[model samples]
Target chain A: MPAIQVTNLHKNFQTKRKAVGLRGSLRSLVRAEYGTVEAVRGLSFAMDPGELLGFIGPNGAGKSTTIKILTGILFPSSGQATVLGFVPWKQRRQLAYQIGTVFGQRPQLWYHLPAIDTFSLFGKIFELDDRETSKRIAFLAEAFDIADLLETPVRKLSLGQRMRCEVAASLLHKPRLLLLDEPSIGLDVVAKQRIRDAIREMASLEGVGVLLTSHDAGDLEALCKRVIIINHGQIVYQDKVSALKRTFLTSKLVEVRYARQVAPDFHIAGTETLKVAKERYGVKLRFEARQTPVEAVMARLSEVGSVVDITISDPPLEEVIAAIYEQAERSEAAIAK
Target chain B: MNEYHPTRTPAWILLIMRELKFLLAVWKTNIASAMEYRAAFIAQMLGMILNNAVYFIFWVIFFDRFRDVRGWELSDMFLVFGVAASAFGLAAFLFGNAFYLSEIIARGRLDYYLSLPRPILLHTVASRSISSGLGDFTYGILSYLASGYCTWDGFGRFLCGVVLACMAFTSFMIIVHSLTFWLGNAAGFAGLALNAMVTFALYPVTLFEGFSKLILFTIVPAALMGALPAEFVRAFSWGALGKLFLGALLLLGLAVLVFHRGLRRYESGSAIQVEV
Candidate 1:
């Protein structure tokens, strides 16, 4: 049986709404308006124990909502979900003992205290006795490379350092399943790599299942084996990371600022210029990696002029998901015909 | 079925005992966090004491002008102030989040507690410390001592009264803040309710009558937190103890009920961005 089994899970939220202007405000004061939002709709999936699964999506996608529901912090509006054979929302506390979580935007560490204080508190909370707690803390400190930084207050730590501590703290009890929501949201490249390396090593060493969520496709590639991409409360794509790369992750978005402008219609073969700034000094372009080589593009770029700055990145997850959705609809139509 | 180990089915009492240890650890962390700047912690605690002292001085001047109001003398005022201050102080000191729990709920900070293996209500409230409240707690004991009512019996009564009042205050705040589950962002509403309770609780319940008195006893619960407890302290009556116990029990029950009921609708702000 799967470690997690979610079938036809749905969650809806009701949010109060008021219009602009005094008249709208006054009307709302007398009679309020509310609208329903489907935060997660008919989401169904299952994961094997110790699997490295990435739940990736853009902001406002259902990734975080689904993770929250799986952790038992959220009750689905309808349908069912079981994590480790326990109904999550119904047996939240029980389920919590087996699962660790890190919500990127939320700091579980006490900001004004040293990271060690929180680690100790979590030890007591998780029911590990003093000696075992200390031993576990020391081991985690070494694994996450956070030993030297434990004595300093959390607030004084860099974002990267703090996040390392945060992740380490979550693992203190050796939960079987780790639910991480955007754990690398704001880390620099070096920091992100460090976190990804440590997480991968831990998951392998502990045989821990990771249902990791992120907005960046890079995280999925770096740490996850299988990938599920969701958007607007629904899954748009799901497959092995290799399959996803070939089908949906092939395109790249490049933004460049040149030292000088040469021509208005400056172009490169095998690449589509999505936007050229009005001043002609900056440009945005896209090219399929299978079709255009990066070295060729760079050679052409150098031929044009000295470059000031350049960034190569994945297209927004929203854009990728939208494309997948459109392709799915077209394929369905063709099959019907 | 999944292959994970069945969750440990600890006895209920065992669960409570573990959670209490968790609570103590959290409280210790809160104080340690507050004491990070030792001088600031001292300043805040002392400032609160001085502030409470100045507020009490007004009563001194009042008694100087006129001796008593309806068998309410300066000493009785001391007992009442002692109970109310200590109750509010204890609630503020230990469960500091109770004062602004609505903000935490509204902002979806409760996710931190909900994800943990502890009782949600206890862990959330005890997460922070209002160091200044330490000063209020000290002033309360001092005030009770100065009331000339600090006999062993009086001290026991004072302790009882303060514990019940503290529970009432904390429970009341929890119930108000839990309304945010249904009503969007009830922070301002909770703040207003807290102010009403605190304001009325500081005054003598005998000062009001009839419908207003009914409101105080049932709705705002200011009389229950203040005057009733003070009366119980002045002279122990089974009737007074029953009333105090009953009031605290009712409020605590309602608080747990309302908060857990509201937990069903906790958005965690994850749904906010998904709004239509």
Candidate 2:
């Protein structure tokens, strides 16, 4: 059976609305007004068992709201969702025993206690006896590389270290699926890379399904096979991650620093130089890989001057996703017109 | 992974045992967390004791000036205050989150409880310990002793009264706070309700007669929590005991039902909150 199945899920929030200033505040006190916010609108999707699916969206796009509904933390306004063959809202407790969750913005570790204390507590919460709990803790501590850090109070650990402990704690019960909402958020580059690598390793080793939601597209590129891009509380794009890259990640950027000073009029064909180093020894350029071959660009650069340093990469995923967002918005505008 | 779950046992008993185990572990962790700031814990606990002592002194002075008001003497004040303080303190210490549940709901902290595989209301209410509750409990016991009704039977009744009052008080707070699910951010209103309950609970039932007495019995139910319970402790009557028992059970049932009803309408906020 699929690890997750959501059909036409809808969530609406009733938000209090008050006008500005003293007069408005007094009027609201007498008869408060409220407005409706459709946070998630008719979202539908399914994930095969053990599949690493990326649910990517910008802020307020209903990614977290959908995840919350799937986890049974928030009830949907309408529609159906099942996790591990159990209806989420009705069978939340049963589903919880079979799934784990990590909310990056909400740390589950007790701030004043050591990570191990929370881990031990979780073992009990999941109904593990002392010996079994100890064995499981050792296993997870090793898996998440949190052995050395577990004894330190969560308040004392760095954000990255605390996050590792948080993830490890969630896995204490050996759940079949892991739902992570923005797991790499607010981490430094190295921390983000470490988290992604560890998550990938754990998923592969245990065959645990992962449904990850993030605004960071890098998280999708590094970890997931299939990707779903949501915008304005709706899915705008869904496909294999490779397909996303092939269709939109067509441009390449290169930065080269020459050992010797290059000529000022130095120009390469079919490539646009974005910036020149103040010392005149380095230049940054971009070219569509479709239009200009990377091998040709490399040969031309070598022909220009002796190369000291070079870096080649695709445009950051944010830029790529932004492009899709613009296309979706324009199409939506057309439909409205 | 599935072997850890024992499936052969009777379902309801197993469910109760598992939830109880989880509760114990959570309570243990809460105490350890409180001890992390030992100095602050001690200070808060002692400060509460001092605060309650000052309030008790006011009663002592009032009774000295006026010997008895409507057959309610200084001793009666002691027993009522003892029941009220001990009950409030016990509720605070055991279910500290009940006091600030509205704020937690408003700030989205309930997410932590909902994600776990345990009873949400029990876990959320019992996850924290109030350091000062110990002090209040101590003060209550001292007040009960000074009332000169410290017989073995009277003490048993006092203990029973405290338990019932704690149930009523905590469940009342839970019901008030659960309104946050319908009314957005009801923390301020909850605080007002708490103050009203505490104020009305400390006064003698004789002080208010017609409408005010009606308010105490039904609306705020302070009479049930303090005066009625105190009267039962002073001399146990089957009728009074049954009334207090039924009242506490009814309030507790209402609390659980209201909270679960509110849970359906819970609109979790995006306001960033750290689980401490």
Among these predicted structures, which one has the highest lDDT?
2
Pairs that collide in candidate 2 are none
lDDT tens string, model 1, A1-337? Answer: 7999999999998877899999999999999998999989899889999999999876788888899999988889999999999999999999999999998888888888889999998998898999999999999999999999999988889989988998999999999999999999889999999999999999999999999999877788799999887776877788998787567778899888999875778799989988888684898899988899988888887788899999998776456656776776687579899
Summed over model 2, clashes come to 0
lDDT of 2 at A306: 92
TM-scores of chain A across candidates: 0.81, 0.91
DockQ of each: 0.36, 0.75
Q: Model 1, B1-276: lDDT tens per residue?
A: 878887876799886777778889988888898899899999999999999999999999998888987767899888888988899889999999888778778878788888998889988888878989889888898899998887899899999999999999999999998898888778889989998998899786668899999899888999877899998998899999999999999999999999999988888874221000
In candidate 1, list every pair of residues with a backbone clash. Answer: none
Instruction: Put down candidate 2 lDDT per residue, A7-80, tens digits, no spaces.
Output: 99889988778899998999999999989998888888899999999999999999999999888999999999
| Clashes per candidate (backbone, < 3 Å) | 0, 0
Residue-wise C-alpha lDDT for candidate 2, range B1-276, written one tens digit per residue: 555855587889987887788888988898898889999999988898899999889999999999888898999999999999999988888889999899999888889889999899999999889989978888888889999878899999999999999999999999999999888778888999899999999997788899988898777988777898899989989988898898899999999999999999887767766666
